[model samples]
Target chain A: MSIRIDQLPRDKFIMPGTAACPGCPLLIGLRQVMMALNGKMSLVIPAGCSSVIPGMSPATSYGVPTIHVPFASSPAVASGLVSAVRMRGNNGPVVVWAGDGASSDIGFAALSGAAARNEDLIYILADNEAYMNTGIQASGTTPWMAWTTTSPNGKTEERKEMALIMLMHKIPYVATASIAYPLDFIAKVRKASQIRGFKFIHLYAPCPPGLKFDDSYTVKIAQLAVETGIWVLWEYNQGKLTISPPSAMYKDKSKRKPLSEYMKLQGRFSKVGEDAMKIYEAKIDAYWNTILKLSELYK
Target chain B: MQETIQRQARKVLVGDHAVAEAVKLARTQVISAYPITPQTLIVERLAEMVDNKEINAKFIRVESEFAALASVYGASAGGARAFTATSSHGLFYMYEMLWWAAASRLPLVMAVVTRSLGPPWNIHDEHTDIMAIRDSGWIIGMAQNVQEALDMTLAAYKITEDSRVLLPVAVGLDGFILSHTAEVLEVPSQEVVDGWLPPRDPHIPYVIEPGGEPITMGNMVKSDAHHMLLKKMMDEAMDGAKNVIHDVFASYAKLTGRNNGDLIECVNCQNSDYVAVATGAWSGDIMKAVSDLREEGYNVGFLRIRFLRPFPEEAIMDVASRARGIIVFDRDYSTGLGGIIAAEMMGLVPQSVSFKGVIAGLAGVDVTPSEVKAAIKDFIDDAERNGPIRIRKTWLMQKMEGGKP
Candidate 1:
């Protein structure tokens, strides 16, 4: 049983006493990450729910020092703070926790510049499909058929390929992780912690409130997301690529779950008709095929 | 208490080197600035001092004005005493981080040689460049001549780093006027400057250093709450800096045998009915002009505004209240708004008193001793005969185009 995260002798975090909604995947994922990291890190958050989630005073949920920087200047502020700490001879890892809105929209310039300079920091983007903090506004990472606040009908555009964008920077480490697989997520965070240069981790955090999904369905929805090829898991490290084979490597057709299995659970995609669903499926197929070709090149 | 009789080495140095020597005496820990005209020589001398080991300091040659200020911000946050120099466009380029340094409450000191803002790109002196950042929450001070330039540089560290006044400071020198001109200055000994100004306080910076695994200094607060803190802190510091400035000036006065009492003044005014308010290198020529007018037996006095920011509003108000009329000799113009200093003084004085502006020496143009003399004479004559409104036609703008000749 591949060492269940709950069963491992991981150090307990003094953070997050308040319960996340029952089976809230993101909170669970964060708990696992914090346990793996074990209090040797600092977190930089922009204007996101994560910035607000840390509890008050002695009841603090974040076990480590967490700074909330401005939305657009997170990368710049992080770089400045990281340099300052390095000057003082501290060797601890500096981590930035950003939402897709911060990473892909407002903070893009600062992020690109920091990565280009190969700053020693880890940037984690918890992409919950849309901007959940502000009532599910369509963000750059929102899928084609998702119905968000801005995208009142169905989203007309494709989701921006953020992990691929990060890969182009030729960073030392870049990976995608999901709540469906806790061990895989923890493994990727641990891998990032070992790397020296700019490391990026894109975690698919499904929001029950924004996705209009049932609380118990978070992990199942995340699993179906990868199985349906809507969220592919991969890592790029110094010109090498590793794509995790689909949930069931043998019986490829059986591994390919219907798109409706993922979308039907969320009200965000309820407005999408059959034709729109077909369009969404085609875009996901195109994206996976490109990823497969790149993976082959690296192999 | 003991009677101390200490003499300093009197030297004939350009304004740039005087500033460099003062900064050296202050023993800054880090000097990060890009080279800009008039101001470049100051940093150049600082670099030489670093190389010669006359001062044990780290000198970082950054890529741009933006980076220069940002680098100092990093250094200052780490508890190192940092300094930088820039002029004109370079000063303008660091505009964004100027507010950052002040808001972050770093006691970083920068020397800005005031040069004219460009269209033709003349590299002569004017006050507009530094004046443009007046509201950036910095403790702004101007030097009237080389002596003040040297004295004020040391004073800057003492004022900015005071626990009560933890804000960035800008010490301004007139471009080519004070920047390039050589003058007699009693540069203080390194030991004396060290005694006057201590190292930066350790507890101020909120940003955490790396090994300590500290968090950066920030978090989301209510907008009104955050702004109120900025306002409350800034107001307290600025108000505190006024007294700190005076005490340091008193100490500096004792060391140099020059009384820099938050201001400099000359009064033919015991019998004189009119006064001129001016500052920087031009104030020297204005003094000569005041003497020439005094010879004509017109009751005239000269009040050189040594410090610009903290405006010395009370002193000017006191002087203007006694004078029959006032003439403001401004080195820079504010386009459609006329002279900035003239406007400021006008706001301070009673409506009963009259004043006119003699906008001169713009873009480093020569405001000769004779021209200042003539303008003062005309201002007095017009003010005494006519009302304050029509004191004199604004003179000296006639020769404002070219750089120093």
Candidate 2:
């Protein structure tokens, strides 16, 4: 997947002066995705921050056609849109831009069905850990020991492994990307755009207000997540698995940063004790071990 | 107007199958549905039809009713005629997408096999499911029998796809009673239907089309006035549906010699002393009761409330005001508020005319023609003996040993 930044289209699909907050990583990721599509994609966005980030009526931020559906029907809507587009002899890619809450909880059934059917769609699940648009409520994708309005004492359950779940569907393409690596994200989007079946990209996006971090630290937090091995960047294509750049380097735990170094930056994890940190570290290590086994099996 | 053509052969079909046949004739390009009791046969038959190339459509077997409707919404927005069907709990499950389809102004058609909502779990004839979504800004209609079920399903596409009324339409058929009971229905020729109801060309500016302008649909409206204005547009569209519905019905009648009036079907309402108002298949039973009472010098009339969403308020007012008393037989009950249809009628009917609500046939309980006749007799007797009866609601078919509230 050799691609240069200068080769990418210069037209800004996510127009300037949008309502997105300063340093919102999802916005940055969406802009890159739009650029990758080169304004040929039709977006189906469910109710979330992105639904509003496109501004209100009469003023849209998206340069491509968009349909904002209910919170739990993005993938289903995309399936129908793809079918209709094909019926009309238009085979353009149909994309679903949804959030963690919608993708992992409210819309899980729809996502699973689309994957099982291998519907022709590009589903991008932007994970900000919590339901940021609804004021930082704990979602299924929220990591363990993360404080949210619904999980004030910190979430007791482990975060949902959505990327692995997507792999279980055996779709044509399934990948995990981050806003911190724009090039990797763009390359994955370009790759997904070329595939013909259900493609899912689980994005690691950092929310400043929701995670109680300074706005400027959005990109830093996202980068640290990959660097610390807390968020792995990888792709699964045609039953083959390969880990991506920075996160791939952490397979040898000796090179991975301590979990506390990543947790200490966000106030949402301030209440995390040392013992909990050890448990989370062990869990992350176990996850990487499982990923390695999957890589071996798929290979 | 196209010239009237020779009618096609008639076939015996259940209400659910009739809806499927109509959908096939309507040339629905995309169909997505989950199987539920009573409504299952509709999707199953459609699926089989799609597989056999009987209907050139994509049948998506969705996981849930929410996705079923959402898939249709997406397909319709992408400039295709789309459809789905559900019953009772399935309709309730897809409640959110119901509003999504309507608010997005997607010209889609959904056939709802009306059934009783659950607690004890019963799948049979009841109107509660469709009635629950009457206020969801979609054009709603209730079919009297299998024939009307087929006709209404065909008319629904025409009504919903009208440039003036680009709202989703739900054609309600009674579960088990109409959905399962087979009746003779005139299945119009594909040529005639094709000539009458052409392919949908939605007037909405924002459709999912490749190479079209980048337009956003269903975006947030922060301003109260803007939000209210969108709602006002829905309201006005609904108001405009009255004419579209009438014209479509008239056009359908001209194409085939069958019409369920425009909105409300009146049976001998002229100079009648009392009128019995009902909907769904049971309206046939009410009409029978009206005829029996008229034979006994009761001078009774029957009005079938076809389109429930638009409410047919003016037509209802016109018919009910002329009658000395109006008896509304509701197949479903609204907890703490009596019957839903009766409640709506109370607001529309004249204050001077006597009105009574008879709640019956709940949980699939059979409201026999004899039972309907007896209820009408009671209402007529009350209106005759006691001028303008005070009892606004009566629970029919309830076994009460003593007087219990």
TM-score of each: 0.76, 0.97
Which numbered prediction scores highest in DockQ against the true structure?
Answer: 2
Please give the fraction of native interface contacts (Cα pairs under 8 Å between A and B) kept by each candidate. Answer: 0.16, 0.72
The alpha-carbon lDDT assigned to residue A33 of candidate 1 equals 66
lDDT of 2 at B237: 93
Q: Which residue pairs show collisions in model 1? A: A16-A61, A85-B209, A85-B210, A90-B211, B272-B299
Q: Give the C-alpha miss distance for residue A70 in model 2, angstroms.
A: 1.2
In the range A200-256, model 2's lDDT, one tens digit per residue, is 999999999999899999989998899889899988989789888767789999898
Please name the candidate that would achieve the greatest lDDT relative to the true structure.
2
Per-residue CA lDDT of model 2 for B1-405, tens digit only, reads 233435666799988999999999999999999999989999999999999999889988899999999999999988889999999999999999998789888898999999887787888778888999988998899999999999999999998888798899999999989999999978889999999988877335348865557988888876879888989999999999999999999989888888879889889875788988899898887888889989988889988889998879898888877878888999987888888889988877777788899899888888788889998898889888886764557799767687664
Evaluate every candidate with DockQ and list the scores.
Answer: 0.17, 0.78
Worst 10 residues of 2 chain B by lDDT: B1-10
